[model samples]
Target: MKTSSPSDAPRPGHSSVAALLQSQGALIALVSILLFGALRYDNFIGWQNVSDVLSNSSKFGLIAVGMAFVIMSGGIDLSVGTVAVLSSVLAARYSNYGIAPGIAAGIVVGLLAGLVNGVLIARFRLMPFIVTLCTYIAARGLALIISDRQTVSISYEHGFDTVGQGDFLALPIPLWIAAAIVLAGALLLRYARFGRAVLAVGGNEEAARLMGLPVVKVKIGVYVISGALAGLAGVIVASQTSGSPTEGVGWELIAIASVVVGGTLLTGGQGSVLNTVTGVLLLSVILNLINFENGYTGGAHLTLGSYWQTIARGLFLLAVILLQSRLARRSP
Candidate 1:
């Protein structure tokens, strides 16, 4: 038997602390922010304000859930945002047909875009970053073309707008939809063999392949799922805003930032849908706070402009990335 020195042994409590930081850090931060906002603002804790945060966060939360899956599978989908825009354009165009057809068309568009990405990456063995980046541009162009570079409004008479605006069980329709997606995602990731394969592939593709895992299939499947969710998000967005080809601009960065803030490794192989939801709420709350701050100081020399929100987002991204780097180093 080989004798090991104390220095070589795992540090007691370190693993637990790191795990806590990785898993619950975003939750902690979100709670702190909520407390701060409630204390700092007279109306931040009101039901109306709370509802706004939850409802607005749902759209990004849906996208972030998909992003968590892709990032966990060691891949990225830059096209998700523009793909969403394209889906929204399609949904608006088809809204006159009926709500069912409109929703189906939007989702199908997303699925098709995802399929192209999956084929390029899994079949052609292209880099995910490059493939998704190209698709991102293409999707944006397609959205612009389909909508004639304009906002397409959905007719309210058809009830198509209810998808985003309606309430279920006293919760916003988008929040209900988002909750369902998150629950389904959590189950699939925690209890499915496909989910295991995803983790294995992300952890080490070559090793997973050698172990007889369906690496290619898993890789392709994650993108498909991501695409489908993004599409659903697009439909919700279209319903909420009537419709717009220009929507979802820069949403990809927001999704990525949410994932990172949620403690998902950019290198992949570890993450949680629940944590990603927390991250979405955190970002949403920050933006909402900025809005409140701006309103409170309106017409004042010290007013924090909308640009301050952008700067704050960038800084938050930087801080999360740094934290991720440090956590990676500390992990055994």
Candidate 2:
């Protein structure tokens, strides 16, 4: 019998690097922004400004947290934003249907969307890219059709305001919910048997199947989870705005960017929910800084606006992929 050396058995040296990146990427990025802003702008790190960033980031954080699971399972879901729009619209319609039906309708629609993706990917072995892209188009079109290409306002729904405007411990209800979901997701992914199953399936599907893991089921399960969360995010967004199908374009890109920036492997298998959370915050923070600085400067810097953010996201993704490729080549 032969035993592997302690150093060779997933020791502290290399493992910590990924962990650090996941846990502190946002904080480090935040610090970097402050340092840069402090040198460049007069009021980059003000208190109200910080809150604004976190507040704005929370919505994207909700979707990114869900996207983390999908990406970790070696899959993608481009339809999340549209599903969210569809769900939010349904939620508003449900207001007429009553609260229970509204919530149920929204959740069911999202679950069904996930089901479609999961079935195609797991049972039919379709590529995640094509499947999700089709759903993206389908879901967005369906949302437009249902809403008649108009925003459906749910201001009349009883307690509708509470869903988005309520507070918990001095934080917004949506933020609290996001935090709770993140905690739950982190726990499930890190400590549960199901979590390991997800990781194994993503890391090596054939091996997971050989080990008797329910690979198909796990993959399907993650898509469902992702869809459900996306739907929930939509509901929250609708609640905040009192309208549906109005603000859900390009959200998938934001979610995907956060997932990648969070340290999740684009190839799948290696990542963490916490990292995704940080990534979302990091992005939100940068955008917040941009907005704050712009406000002070009279919005003269349109170049530092959403377009710049998109370019930053692309550059960050390219950098991470290249770094990972180099590291993979160096590793055993």
Candidate 3:
């Protein structure tokens, strides 16, 4: 008889009802929201709006994809946002050289940062939260110092302008890049041996270790993936708005929220990258719906402030978590 891996062992909170809801609820909500928007708002599902939504969500999607891997492995990286800012500054400073150089430099820096985080956590056995938190603080500070606490405008030389501004198949280039990354991530999670290892590591590290899994390598790899994606997001930011010392501030929160809302447990393991994407899209659509509401009602539906959207995001996350909790409690 086949034996269950440590992660797959019978345990509390693995309730079938809760698990099913977590796995399927996010998609259902997303579909319902889309239907509502399509009915209530004119052209809500139109191509141009869809393009804009996808473009705006692409950067976050990248970060969330990496974050998903980290979380699924029962780890967290608080530095992703600040890492993106650091990479953005680097990319902008080197933009005069050429498109490829700038992009490469940014991604390389991100990889290095991730490697540092991985070593500190896996090799040194430091707590992931504390290690990543320190990295977050340091990365942001370095970004500010390197940029002189100012925005570094890109030269846009050597076809560098095409990255963010370009389009393919009527979709934004950033969206295309983000899509490729997400697809790659999905493939890694679905069919790769490493994917199973990651879930196992997250589900029960000690058990996985007993099974002879390369726990250290798995931990290191997830962080590297997170850092690489953060770097890519930074390059996109530089392409769109140049590099600001302040870019990507608090982006980690957005990534976390998106993942959680997508039904990924904060405890790690038992999650889906595809659901994460749906969560990203759902949040984006909510923002879009909010804007449409305000436009249609001439500000009657919402207060006149940017913070409302933040509040909405917060409320949405809270609601989903509560529902998940209630369902989890109902698990028998």
Evaluated with lDDT, which candidate comes out highest? 3
All candidates in order of lDDT, best leading = 3, 1, 2
**Per-residue lDDT for 120-153 in model 3, tens only?**
9999999999999999999999999999999999
Query: Total backbone clashes of model 3?
Result: 0
Q: If scored against the real structure, what TM-score would every candidate get?
A: 0.93, 0.85, 0.91
Report how far residue 276 has shifted in candidate 2, in Å.
Answer: 0.5
- Positional deviation of 71 in candidate 2, in angstroms? 1.3
What lDDT would each prediction earn against the true structure?
A: 0.85, 0.78, 0.88
Model 3 worst lDDT window (10 residues): 296-305
Point out the higher-scoring one by lDDT: 2 or 3. Answer: 3
- For each candidate in turn, give its C-alpha RMSD to the true structure in angstroms: 2.7, 4.6, 5.3
lDDT by residue for model 1 (1-332), tens: 98999997668688667667667777877788889878777799898899978988887988898888889999999999999999988887788888898899889998888888988999999999999999999999998888888998986778898998999888899999999999999899899998888888888889999999998889889899888888988998888885687788899888998998888888787888888888888899888877777776434433566787789867875776677567656756
Which of the numbered candidates is closest to the native, going by highest TM-score? 1
What does candidate 2's lDDT look like per residue over 55-95, in tens digits? 66667887898788888888988989999899988887776
Off by over 4 Å in 1: 1-10, 297-302
What's each prediction's clash count? 0, 0, 0
RMSD of 3: 5.3
**Residue 251 lDDT in model 3?**
91
